[model samples]
Target: MNAFPPAQALSGRRPAVAVWPWPIALGLLTVFGLLSALLGQHGIWLALSWAALSLPLIVTVICLVRAWSRPSDKGGRS
Candidate 1:
């Protein structure tokens, strides 16, 4: 038997949010950052590329920290 239901089953409704935008935006930013860093390695392009690259990393760290801080669904706490 399953210990818990899937999130979709629990929700039982379509999500209003469109999921593709953020991921697409992040991917574009990464691509731009890479191309800029490699192809435009001198002035403003380099700086913008660095900034763009760091944003994804910053988002990832923030998400990881938030997920780790949350209590586990498996009930680790007594």
Candidate 2:
């Protein structure tokens, strides 16, 4: 017999939360900002809008890279 109980019994499972809203909102903002910049007349407004749109994207990329570089718990599990 195994010393450890079955994995399923060790932890209670819960429904996952939907986490795509932020990314979706950011993507929509970027698309709208770019479209406005291309079709509208204000040059400074366009630059500012594009810069604002880039902030979330940059943050997301940094988070993804950090997560990818961190050590996983693969082999540590029995």
Candidate 3:
């Protein structure tokens, strides 16, 4: 017998975000990026904001590609 339940049973029809950390990190990054762009100092602020915005997008893309190419379920079920 299987030691754990089936993947679908554990998934329980939850949203994708429930299983990913990047979504929450990306959200926080976006909010901080916006705030930095609006309220931060001039020079460094632009750089910081751009990095904040782009880093998550790049990471998300990389993660998506990796996840797509891989055959295993590294992040558990749904």
Candidate order by TM-score, decreasing, is 1, 3, 2
Give the TM-score of each candidate: 0.65, 0.52, 0.55
When 1 and 3 are scored with TM-score, the better candidate is 1
lDDT of 2 by residue, 1-78 (tens): 113334543454423446887778778778877777777748887886788678778877887776566556232122
Each prediction's RMSD to truth: 7.2, 8.3, 6.4
Give a tens-digit lDDT track for model 3, residues 1-78.
Answer: 112345644666533334456578889989888889899868899789999999887986887777677667544432
* lDDT scores of the candidates, listed in order: 0.73, 0.63, 0.70
**Clashing pairs for predicted structure model 2, backbone only:** none
Give me the candidate number with maximum TM-score: 1
Count: clashes, candidate 1: 0
C-alpha lDDT of candidate 1 relative to the true structure: 0.73
Per-residue error (Å), model 3, residue 52: 0.5
Q: How many clashing residue pairs are found in candidate 3?
A: 0
**Candidate that scores best on lDDT:** 1
TM-score of 3: 0.55
TM-score of 1: 0.65
Which segments of candidate 1 are over 4 A away from where they belong?
Answer: 1-16, 72-78
**Residues 1-78 of candidate 1: C-alpha lDDT, one tens digit per residue:** 123345644565533556788789889999999999899988999999999999889888987776567656433221
